[model samples]
Target: MRINILQHTPNEGPGSLLEWAQANGHQTFVYHPYHFGYLPTAEETDMLFILGGPMNPNTDLPWIKKERQLIQELLDKDAPMLGVCYGAQQIAKTLGCQISEAPAKEVGWAPVYRKSKIVPGLPEKLLVLHWHEDMFEIPKHADLLFSSNDVRNQGFIMNHRIVGLQFHLEPQADNVREMVVNDFPYIENSVLNQSAADILKTPVPEENKKTMFKILNYITGD
Candidate 1:
């Protein structure tokens, strides 16, 4: 599989997703719009793995709007795509849904229960990394995937090939710890309800690869 990661921040790169791609003999490319400006074509990637970011999708930035159009075009192709955090918000915006304030910021390690048929070899609930103040409404055509007390629309699947997750199943313990140490300046302590240590303290196994990979596999099955 070939995966293209749309990275937003220097801190939140494609953690587990990149690892899976490498381990499974897949090629990977990353786009850092924070430094690279608007991208050229969404058609460049076989599978799109949009990573998390601190920027809200509703911001009046031209890049945000341009990315929205690009995402719409990608969705039109009906290819396998996964959007996380701000990426998910962009996906929701492309689908004509609301991307506004969540009930509250969901920081730290949170639990998300699975609810859709798309999930492959799924469990009841899983501990996923999370750090976002914004959330998206479930698109009219999307099925509910997972949720917590603060947010109902934690994840959604727009079509058979596209998936959007507000949580960060792509990051594990060591990466979370790295973010806490390296990206501490970016986090808003007032909004981020949990401390960095507390977030990293959450349970996440080194072999917790199947859940996210299951979503990817279902979309890109043989």
Candidate 2:
């Protein structure tokens, strides 16, 4: 399988996704609009994995809009797509939904309750890494996948192929450090803020590569 990853920012680039892709013999390419160049053409790849970012997906930045457009095309094609955090918001906006301030910011290990057939190894709930101030409303056409304490709409799936997880599954050691060191500005001084500094003290237990591969298989498998 070939996966095209839209790395939203330098720090939040594909984490476990990249490792699994390589270990499983899947080809992966990264195109970071903030670092590399423009977004790719819709036909450039078979699968799309959009990583997290501090920017709101609805921002008027030209690159943001381009990403939204590309996502819409992928959704139309029923291509396998996974959106994390801001990427999840992008999926919502492109699907004609909205993202707003969550009742409370979820920062740290959150128990995401899986409510659908989308995720494997999901209990009635399971602890996952979470860090976001925004929550998305599931698109009418998408299946609601999961929820958490601070956010009711934590995960959703579009046509079984497009999966959106608001939590972080790729926060390996170095990834967490990058987010803390490079993207620390988003933490500010707010009490609601959660940082890598805090999460490192307590991290989400890493998902086994097999579980992650199963997740991708569920999304990208024909």
Candidate 3:
């Protein structure tokens, strides 16, 4: 399978997702639409993974607009796709959902509870990495998957192929370090936000990687 990853920033890359692809013997490609303004077509993408970023989908930025269009195109074909954080907001916006400021900026490790049993293998409660200020309204006809105390919409699945997660489950230790270093400014002193040392010092749980692979497998019909 040809898996195309749309990365919006330098720090946020496909961490465990890339590992999952490699381990499964699938070809993987990464594109920086923010840097080059290029995106993979639906025909070329057997599976699409949109990573997190600092940007919001509500903005009028050209690259963000283009990426949303590409997401819409893929959705029209019922293509398998997973969007994380900002990318998830992009997907919601494309589906005519509203994007607004979250009650509070949630950063670092947080617990998200499974709201529905639509997606198997997801625990009733799981600690995942989060770094977002904006949240998306669940798209029409989509099933709500998970929710956190700070954010009601942590994840949703649509058409059984489109999945959106408002947290970071793909990041390994190294990926978390890069995110903490590069996007440190986004983290502030708040109840939900964590300090740089705390974020980096905490080990990446193995269950996070396992759940990530399960979601990938579920979306790709594995």
Candidate 4:
């Protein structure tokens, strides 16, 4: 399978998702639309994974608009896609859902409760890494999958193929460190946020990788 990733920043690459693809022998390609201003068409994408970023979907940028158009094109085909954080917000906005500031910025390891059994075997509550100030409203006809105390729309699943997660489950240890180092300012002076040292020192749980792989498998019809 051809797994195409839309990465927004150098620091935020496809961490465990790349790992999963490699272990499964799937071909992977990544596009940096924020930097390169190019995106894959729906015909070229067997599966699409949109990674997180600091920018919101509503940003008045040409590449943002193009990316949203690509998202809509892929959705029209019911392509297998997974959007993370800002990527999720982009998907929500394209689906005619609202994007607003979260009650509080979530930038650390936080617990998200599973609200639906769309992806079976997820624990009732799972600790996942988060780093975003904006949140997306669940799209119409989409099933809410997870929720955190600070963010109600942690995840959503639509058509059993498209998935949107507002947290970071694909980050490995180095990926987390890079995010902490590059985006440190977002966590400062926030009660809901965790310290950089704490966020980095804590080991990436084994279950996090397993759950990510599980979601990948589920989305791709493995």
Candidate 5:
């Protein structure tokens, strides 16, 4: 399969998603829209994976607008998609949903509980990587998959082919480091946000990695 990845920033990447794609013998391509400001059509790719970023998906940027168009094209075809943080917000915006500021910034290993069994292997409650102050509403006709105390609409599934996760389940140790090094300004010693020292001290949960693979398998029907 040809998997096309849209990486919004240099620090935030595909993380464990790259491992799963390579392990499954799937060809992967990455597009850095922030650097190049380009988005390819969905016709050439078998699947689309959108990674996280600090920018708002509803911003009046040309690339963001193009990205939304590409998402719509993919949705029309019911193409398989996995969208993280910013990616999830893009999906919601494309589906005519509201994207607003979260109650609080959730930046650390926070608890995300499964709300539906739409996809298996997700634990009832587990700490997942989170780094965002924006929240997206669950799209119409989409099933809510997971919820966090800080963000009610954490994860959702649309048409079974598309999945949106507000948390970063694909973060490996190095991936987390890259995020911390580049986006350290968001980290704070608040009740919800964790300090940089604490975030770096804790390791990425093994179950989160397992859940990422499960999500990939479920979306691809592998």
Candidate 6:
């Protein structure tokens, strides 16, 4: 499979997704919009993997608008796509849902429950990494896959091809370290945020890696 990754920042590159793609013998391509401010044509890739970032989608940014246009093009093609955190917000906005600031910023390990049985393979309760303060309404015709207390729309699967996850399931220990180094300022000692020390201590990498593989496989129809 030809998978294209849209990376918004340097630190938030495809972590476990790249690992999974390589292990499965799938070719991967990356587009760094922060550097280039452009994305390649949708026909060039079979699947689109949108990574998270510190940027908000509800702004007058030109790149954000272009990214949403690309997303709409891919959706028209019925291409398999996955969005994480900020990326998920982009997808939601393109699908005609508005993005809103979350009640509390969930920045550490949190429990997310499965909201539907149609999307199987995930557990009833998953302890995943949370790092975003923006949330989106579930798009029309999309099934909510996961939800938490702070974020009701933790994840959704649209048309059985597009998947959006509010939490980070692809981050490994090193990836988290890089994220903390680049985006540590967002982490305040609030009831919803986790300290850098506690975030580093969370043992969710291995389990998250396993779940990520399953989710990718299901989305890509492998």
> Which is the winner by lDDT between candidate 2 and candidate 6?
6
Pairs of residues clashing in candidate 2 = none
Checking candidate 4 for backbone clashes, the offending pairs are none
Give the per-residue lDDT digits (tens) of candidate 5, residues 167-200: 8999899999989888888787434757887898
Give a tens-digit lDDT track for model 2, residues 1-222: 778888877778787888778876888888888665577788887888988887897678888888888998887877888889998889889988888887776666667777786566555656677768887889888888888866788888877688887888766777777777776665554334556577666654655334456677788662
lDDT of 1: 0.78
- Per-residue C-alpha lDDT of model 1 across residues 1-222, encoded as one tens digit per residue: 567778888778787788778877889978777688857486776788888887988889888888888787877877688999999888888888988888877777667777776666777787777787789989888899888766888998866788889988887666787777886654565244667666666677543566887877777773
C-alpha lDDT values of all predictions? 0.78, 0.77, 0.90, 0.89, 0.89, 0.87
Model 6, span 114-200: residue lDDT tens: 898766677788888888888988999999999998779999998888999999989888898888788787788444657888887
List runs of model 5 lying over 4 Å from the truth.
Answer: none
lDDT of 4 by residue, 119-208 (tens): 878888888898888899999999999999877889999998989999999999999999989988888855465788888888888888
Give candidate 2 misplaced runs (Cα > 4 Å): 185-197, 208-211
Model 3 ranges with Cα > 4 A deviation? none
* Alpha carbon lDDT at 212, candidate 2: 52
Is candidate 2 or 4 superior in lDDT?
A: 4
What lDDT is reached at residue 142 by model 4?
A: 96
TM-score between model 3 and native = 0.97
Off by over 4 Å in 4: none
lDDT of 5: 0.89
lDDT for model 4, on a 0 to 1 scale? 0.89
lDDT by residue for model 3 (8-116), tens = 8999999999899999999999999888989988889888899988888878988788888888888988888999999899899999999999888899898999998
